[model samples]
Target: MSKIFEVPLYPYQRCADQDQATPVRHKVVVVGAGPVGLALAIDLAMQDVPVVVIDENDKVSWGSRAICFAKRPLEILDRLGCGDPMVDKGVVWNLGKVYFDERQVFGFNLLPEEGHKRPAFINLQQYYMEQYLVDRVRQLQAEGKPIELRGGNKVVEVTQDDERAELTISTPDGPYRVQADFAIACDGAASPIRTMMGLDFVGRVFEDNFLIADVVMEAKFPTERWFWFDPPFNRGQSALLHKQPDNVWRIDFQLGWDIDRAEELKPENIDRRLKAMLGDDISYELEWSSIYTFQCRRMDKFHQGRVIFAGDAAHQVSPFGARGANSGLQDTDNLAWKLKLVIDGKAPVTLLDSYDAERVHGADENILNSSRSTDFITPKSEISRIFRDAVLDLSERYEATRPMVNSGRLSVPCTYDGSPLNGDDCALMPARTRPGSPMVDAPVPGGWLLDRTGFGFQLMTIDENAPEALDVDGIEVKRLALTTPGDADGYLKQRYLGDANSAVYLVRPDQHVAARWDHYDEAAVKAALLKAIGR
Candidate 1:
């Protein structure tokens, strides 16, 4: 098939003929060139691993979906060396205001503390994010790295055995086959890979449809997030206004399930509502608009043989808390390192199973949290609505409940508690922070802290009984004392030890604590490390 679009061909495609006989293969094959897929490709390539990324789209879509970027994802991008560019271009927001009957019921700050390495969230269009990742991937490919981007190529079939995955991709020319050590499906929620594998995507699909519009407005609006419940212009409807780059704003209107999808999205209908909501004096130009039905679903399993699922393919949550893309990117961040470990022979193949287990748990939790927020925002029954309204009224009198009223639940970092990689004792304790179970940030000597830094096995020990040095080849051991007496014990009190004592904590690259011992035994620590890393 001849090229029908004006999009430029990826550099890898330019020399297709010369390498036709070589039979393209890579350490990993990533399907779909969305933000998550591209990010994973670049990250693995940065680690000196070969990656080949394929996408059906010739160019990035112009639609403005997924405009919110969360803190965890930004941290992942920072590891890839692209976080600063994104943070520079996007608007950082911390405060969110919730309204009931046009009255401000409560307000909360997203970034509770400012001096941290990353912010709470950023506002940027999905298209721009994809472009940024694509650009970086291309740059890495140009440097003679093992990163390749193939556009207008779609995966038609996948066959995976215990060792490697074979993919039959349909390119513009015709169908071709490629082999890789592993396959990652970053395709969207309606992933054909997941369906082809006969995996069950079980969850609820809400009846209400949401209308999203990105408009260029001249009116002055606060940089903070604004939400309206039961507004005068649209009764029984909730509207959200979020600031975006270039004076553009993202607006969402809850159109009940009964309305016709086509009619509700018409320019006339949207213009009428905007006029009523903002008054006649406000002027704005519509940039893009679309209507969508939200769903909360997760695949029965994140892996089938050597083929793995990441991002939306593994799970999908409602956009209420902006968990959709955030969760997907986090999946990539978790899976990339594990795959590298297995390919490099640093760990056993069993380590890959932990990726599926840990990420699936994260996806399930995100679905539950986002679903609960959606239920509170759009109650189905009259009784539920009354209860919600009463709660909002009660919150006005009680200052302690204001945070809950503003946002149902804060987007907390996730943890892998019951995984086989985690020790029995490690799974029994709770986190110090609300979502603190994932990784502990405790004080150490010389103003340097011990945390999960890269994709590999890690062990942090402060016990004097622990071995003075580590003998493991691929493991990193840090021995440091907490500078502040109360700080270290306060951080790990609930999670590891009930009392302040010298202890050793084994952590995975994904930031999950694997094992902890109050008094370190060299043999026991070695066994835990081998087990956690699947050596």
Candidate 2:
């Protein structure tokens, strides 16, 4: 194994008791050291929020799980200060091909636009992702940011009320109690905190199991997503192939639920499958393998009193669309800012409710797309198979029917169209950049438009100078001169301003469009900011 895949165990330290005299209390207690939890903790710490993360495991995830990350998540990571490292260490790809048996049906590209800083997707091991996030947390700690990570610390019991949450954490030494103003459950799908709170995740249970194998080999395969249905190597089932860093290849095989788990996982049984796909000429070594079942489910609510849920703890999706971890990262991105505001008293506690609403909307979009992709890939009934086959057959001949053939709708950021935080839309403004949509990246003078917008509310003005600094607190005013160095080539004007020469937009901390106007309006901006904070 390469050094990049080596698992590093973080030493667990003894924490002071909360039951003792003058107990310590944390502003935020995150109940998982996984990627989502670490990312959220790091984001909060960057904003000077005191956060402590606890996890049962001392090391990162062992195998290559959740390897594909989309552009949106990369941008979110960039905002959190860990994007460049991940992009540098991972394989970048924007092209994907779909195959019907041995014949290629069609191919597509994700990065059809230009001037974006990050690629459409990158393939890196989950361990590396977690490690990068952990490193970011440590860097913040060194800067005197109150971010504490406790590995080997497990939350055995959890209880939360309206104002605070009390948790019993078990370490190597013994169990101790800790309290926090708010508790975020980034724990995996089997969340103990969620179960303790009597929450149930309700959705579809797929009847199929997928066998994923990460093998180390040097093959002349293009760095593109290749998905096959009823391929010759894996008869009557679906298969997926993608490239990972350190010459590792991730291969997934769709196995029916009836197969013997033990029998299929054996080296010999696994060898047969790989040999059939790669041929006897290619030699490879298997690094890891696992079997997983698909489930698209989520809790009835993400927030209950002072306890909240993010990532897999809140929802789950089929692996077909690579929505699992990417969406989880988005959950934290949408949440960390809101949590920080509430903790600082800049916003009411109800601001957290918007996090729940927005993330729930994102989860539902992911589930719907994932479920459709799952159905298309592994048709459950005879009618489903017939229609799937028909679509596949027609895709080769007709371009019109090609859109119906969805191997997997690759992950994309969901827009909170009907979100309560959205403000009134400017009638003449372009609909694509309207309220509730993420800020589209465009080339600016020195960097990208997104790079110019910092971690607070921003007032973006196009084609004209931004109005004089407002008295509003925590809002940054940014002016963009279109056709100049600020927007040299006019892409920003074409994409954002359209035919209008001057417009002002109120962007939220998370970079979503809060409101837009033909001219800057102080009262409208104030109202939009208030709505964004869930007032």
TM-score of each: 0.88, 0.96
After superposition on all C-alphas, the RMSD of every candidate to the true structure, in Å, is 4.2, 1.8
C-alpha-based local distance difference test score of model 1: 0.74
- lDDT tens digits by residue: candidate 1, 1-535: 0121235535236336234754466689899888889888988998788888888876765667888888778877776767877899899988888887778887778877423556788998887787788778877878887887887787888887777888888766777788888889988878988777777688999888888988888768878888877878779878888998988889888888888878888899999988888888888989889988878888887877788888888888778788888887788877887888788887778888888888888888988887887788888899988887888877767887665553435465677667667662432334442111455444333331423354555565543345444756665654433322544445434434545455666656655566776666777777777777766
Q: After best superposition, candidate 2 residue 466: deviation in angstroms? A: 3.5
Candidate 2, run of 10 with poorest lDDT: 475-484
Q: On a 0 to 1 TM-score scale, where does candidate 2 land against the true structure?
A: 0.96
Q: In candidate 1, which residue pairs get closer than 3 Å at backbone N, Cα or C atoms, i.e. clash?
A: none
Q: Give candidate 1 misplaced runs (Cα > 4 Å).
A: 1-23, 142-144, 400-410, 424-430, 433-436, 440-452, 461-482, 485-503, 517-520
Total clashing pairs for each candidate = 0, 0
**Would you give me the overall lDDT of model 2?**
0.86
